[model samples]
Target chain A: MLFTIAWRNIWRNKRRTLIVLSSVVVGVVALIMNDSLSIGMIRQMFENQLGSHVAHMQIHKRGFNDNKVIQSVVPDQKRVEEALRSTPEVKYFSRRVVTFGLVSSAINSSGAAIIGVEPDREPNITIIKKSIIEGRYLSGASHEVVIGKKMADKLSVGIGDKIVGMASTVSGAVGSDMFRVVGIFRTVSSEFDKSYVFISLGNAQEMLELGKDVSEFAIILRDRGLVEMVKSKIAARLGANYEVLSYADLMPLILAQMQMYKESMFIVYIIIGLALIFGIINATLMSVFERMQEFGVLMAIGMKNSRLFYMIMLEALVIGVLGTVVGMVVGLAMYLPLSAYGIDLSMFSESLTSFGVGSTIYPVLTLQSIVGILIVIPVFAVLGALYPALKAIRLEPVSAIRYV
Target chain B: MNIIEIKDVEKTYHDNGVPVHALRGVTMTVERGEFLVIAGPSGSGKTTLLNVLGALDTPTKGKVYLEGEDLSTKSRNEIASIRLHKLGFVFQAYNLIPVLSALENIEFTMMLRGIPEKERHERAMALMEELDIAELADKRPNEMSGGQQQRVAVARAMVNDPSIILADEPTANLDTKTGANLLDLMQRMNEEKNLTFVFSSHDPQVI
Candidate 1:
């Protein structure tokens, strides 16, 4: 009876009820859209960072990340490469030899990190080819190099232009190598654009005067969730001499920043939900006051105050539940594409990428997030009912009956 | 045995700063199954006494007992349960919940008793059938005329089969003929069910 009465009571004034419920629906939809978009963008960023930049895990000689010295190269390349391939997670494994150098095309010169990669395995790990705005990927046996778009622009070089790379070797010897600028590529990260230059690993090794030595073996895996576990297993198998770092371990600052942003967004959602619940509570209280004569009659006809209290609360719950369910449904529909596809910030791509956000920001959806909205809305609704229920029980029979 | 006992009940209200007395040391006793009428002009303590007797209000001073239990010590919920199980009330203006149809209004009291729907529906339809408003059972309050609505109200009042039915100017909103017919239906219910009738009115026939 309580539910029956409460349901009917909502439609008692269809226009007023519609106004109240529509507000709730709007709040819910807005929250869902925001949540989905945030999730989707972050997921895409994580994937891009993992597959194109960091890979799942890396094995380094002790102290390599902190001190990138020439002597930091892994000593046993044959054994390390074999051990890495022994695991099923080893979808692609390659070596990268990195050093700071100046690339000059006679007209200009700019400082850059020259990354040596195997022609056969580099594309399997980093998305270098897809990023190529012009020219072709590395061809084995050619002393060709790929420079970042920014580097190419600064140096005034294009595909087929001769460029000279100069760097100091880890052994304190000045090293210089000449190469053809075979490709120019765009990177999502501004830092990558300003500093990164990719070349065939054999050429980099020869130029740096390193005898078949590699700085580290970068690896890709089937699932990113296993990054930590894989790192640990590799560490256990390889012993203390070798160190392993997962993507998060390599980029702690980015991961922490993302986590903080997510938490702050949740706070914003809570504030919105709280305000909506206040509107619901106030409306119900006003209606109760307006319907005092009815309550008085109900009380006179043997309707217990408890029953009356239940009736009032049921009405609130109905609005809460109905609004939340509908809102989530509508919101998720928008969330999926908005989060995954992101609201295109392409209009300001350069400005946004410089600030770390990509050109497109997508919205994402998750079950846990949907459940959170479900839990929060009803709690807010019930919280809104507290004062009104107290008022209903305390109203006087004679005076309330006299109320028109 | 008397069903109601009021002892030295004094009721007052604050009209702005000065206190106004609605009932002054009033006393009354009434037996079961008796038709009692308390009539007075507005603000003459009639409704005030009725509110106290109905356990919907407490006297400013003194005590009220229903079936020999003190009204003071019982909790608000206890008072409501007492009202539900042992008393029934009818009022002017139909006073039906606009949301519920006439049949639902009659089942409302039984619902408060925690009776299941099937039993409550059966009892409601049976009473509404007796009042000759069964044909209008599904109609909301606005759909029925003044006379039909009053008859439905009477059916709701008697549906619980309680010891007493209190009507506070039950015919105040109806035309004279509709009022007369409404009162006749209540009087007939009083005779057939041996129901106790307690009402406040200026009508000589009702008194």
Candidate 2:
């Protein structure tokens, strides 16, 4: 009966309840949209990094990560490859010999981190070949280099032009090789484009005097979700000779960047939650005091103050659930199509690239985010009702009956 | 047996630092099955005296005992339980929960006591029939006339079969004929049920 009374009481002043409901609905819709967009952008950052550079997992020699010298190459490449091939989770793996060297053209010179890869295997590991703009990707064990566009521009070199690459070999001797630029690629990050240059693994091994020894293995999985199981299986098969690391371990900096975004977004949610608290508190308090005399009569006849308090809370629950449902409907109406087509942020491409995200983003609403909002609305409603419910319970029946 | 006892009760109000004494030293008592009228002009403390006797307010300097229990010794919740089971109150305005129908308003006190729906429903209907407001059972307070709402208030007060019923200006909102009719109804219930009735009114017609 009290529940029925509470439900009907909310509609007693239609304007007041509507105003509160609209505020809650609008607030929830805005919050859901904000959450979806943030999730989309964060997802893009992870995909871009994993797809372009960091594969799902990497295998290296125990101390190879601390120091990237030619002597730190994987002690036994054939063993690692055989184990990886046996693992069903690993769809693709690439062998690479990495080093830093100075490449000089006739007109200019700049320092570059050089990666030596098998042309066929490299394509399966990264999307760099697809990003090539100027020329063809490296084909075989020729003295051919695929440099970034920024690096080619800095060195004033183009495809079919010769550039001298100089580095120290495993024997502690300086080695120099002449290479023709075969491709120039541009990734989302201009800084990466300016510093990374790639050559065939055989050419790199010969120039650096490393015999069939590769720096690391980059593995791509059939499903990215299988990364952990694959990493663990590979680690168990290879033992302590090699260190296995997931993408998160391989890129601590990116993980920190994601954490920073989540922290700032948490602050935004807090601000929105506080606003909801105040709006609900104001509306419920008004209703409670407006019916002060009626409540007085109820108390005088023997309704406990606690019962009255709960009735007020029941009203808040109705408002919270109603507003949240309406807000979710409106939010889904706006986000579903937006997720399918994606929002173009090309106008802010420069800023986005600095943060290592793509220009166009597809908003994704996760189940966790939906459940989070559903939980938050009622909590806020309860918090908002506390003050008014306390005030209602504090009403002296005698004075309340006298209240005009 | 004494149903209510007020001993040298005093009530004072502070209105912005100015003390206004609503009740001076007053003593009163009423036995069970008594029908009494507390007559006074405006500001004469008739309502104040009734409020203190009903345990709605504590006496400033004295004690009020209802059914041989000192109200001052009880906690708020205990007092509320006593009021729920021992006393019924009817106010000047009908004060029915505007959202409830007449039958619901009459059944509200029993519901608070956790009475079963079927039993309370029968009791409320019988009382509504006795009050001649059975046809208005489904009407909300705002949809009913003043006299009809007052009758619902009376039914609500008497629904619990309390030891005592307190009516403060129950007919102030009704016309003379309606007011007399309400008094006669109360008087008949008082005699038939052997229930104690107490009222405060300045109207000569009610007196």
Candidate 3:
């Protein structure tokens, strides 16, 4: 009976009820848009890292990651290559002999991380081949190199210029090589661009005197979701000499960034919840004060105070539910088409790349987030109505009836 | 058996900074199945006395007993329960919940009592017919006349089969003929069901 009464009573002042409902709808829409944008940006950042530099998984010597020394080269390169070939999920893999060296041009010299990669297989695993701005990809072991555009600018060297790379060999001898810059590439991350220079694997091994040994195998997968499964399979096939690690293990900073985003989202939820509570309280309080005499008469005629409180709360609940359903419908209406087409931030691509995000992003709406909105709205509505309902019950029947 | 007992009940109200006495140590008793009228002019404490008798207001001093139980010793919730099950009221303004239809207004008390819907509807319809307001059952208070809304209010009070009905100026907004007819209906119900009715009115015409 109170349900029926409350449902009808809320419509007594249609303008007031609509005001409260509008605030709720607006709040929910803002929450949905904010959530979608955050999720989209985070997903883009992870994808850029995985597609450009960090493939789904990597294989290296046991202590290679902690200390990048030439002595920690993989012991059995042939057996690891065979395991990777047998794994169906491994789309492409490249052998790499990486070392920190100084690359000096005629006019400038700077420290750089030199990655000696198999030129033919490296193109299938990383985006560096597509990101080349000027000149062609390296074809053979003719001392041809591909350096980042930022590194090229720092060296004041263009395509076809010869740069000398000096590094220490595994045998404790200083080895120096001169390579022609065949390609200059620009990546999404400026940090990555300023630091890496790649060369042919055979030439790198000959110069560094590490014959037939590479430091790591960067493996790209057909499905990113199957990364763990494929990593386990490769680990089982190879012996304890090889270490297989997923992208998450290889880059802990990205995971930490994701965790920080999640914490900030929780704070946003609390702030939105507080705003909704105030909206509901103000509207319900006005209604309560207007019905002061009516409540007095209700109590005088044997209506229980608890029942009156329940009726007021029921009114708030009805408004909360009605507003939430409408907000979700409207929000999804705006979200579905945009999710299909995606939001393009290409105009600000430079700024986005600095943050390590792709130019285009697709907004994702998860079931957990949708359920969170549903649970939060009505709970806040009840909280907002509590003080006003208490005041209604405390009304003195005799004095309230006489109130002018 | 005495249905109500008041022993030297006194009530005071604060007006701005001054205390005004509304009830000055008054005492009264009424037997069961009796109809009583409390008559006084404005500011003469008739409404205050009725409010104390109905347990709507507590006295500053002394005690009020309903059915041999001291109401002053009871908690607020206990008083509310007593009012729900044992007492009914009709206010001067014909205080029908504006949103509810006439039949729903009459059914309100029975609904609070947790009566089955079927039983509540039947009792409400029977009472509406007896009061000759059966056709107004579906009409809201705003759609009905003053006399019809009061009929619905009176029917609501009696639907729970309360032990006593306290009416504060029940005919204050009605015409002379309508007030007389309403009084006649109450007298017939009182005689037929042996129910108690107490009304407070300042009008000599109603008396």
Top candidate when judged by DockQ against the true structure: 1
- Better model by TM-score, 2 or 3? 2
Stretches off by above 4 angstroms in model 3 are A85-92, A102-112, A129-187, A221-241
Candidate 2 per-residue lDDT over residues A207-266, each given as its tens digit: 899888899999999988777788888899999999888998887887787788777767
Q: Candidate 3 - CAPRI tier?
A: medium
Candidate 2: lDDT of A26? Answer: 87
Native contact recovery (fnat) for each candidate is: 0.89, 0.78, 0.84
Q: Which stretches of candidate 2 lie over 4 Å from their true place?
A: A102-111, A132-136, A141-144, A147-168, A171-190, A259-266
TM-score of each: 0.95, 0.92, 0.91
- Please give, for residues B1-207, the per-residue lDDT of candidate 1 as tens digits: 878889999988898978999999988886777777888776677777778888877999988888899999998678878888878777767788788899998888888888899999999988887888889989999999978887887777787777777777888788888888887887787787778888888666655
lDDT: worst 10-residue window of model 3 chain B: B180-189
Cα distance off (Å), candidate 2, residue A35:
2.6
Candidate 2, residue A217: the lDDT equals 95
lDDT of 3 by residue, A107-167 (tens): 9998988889898998888889998999988897589989988899999999999999988
> Per-residue lDDT of B1-207 in model 3, one digit per residue for the tens?
988999998899899979999998898898878888899897898888889999999999999999999999998788888998989888889989999999999998888888999999999999999878999989999999998888888898888888899888889899989888888878887899888999989899888
Report the CAPRI category for model 2. Answer: medium
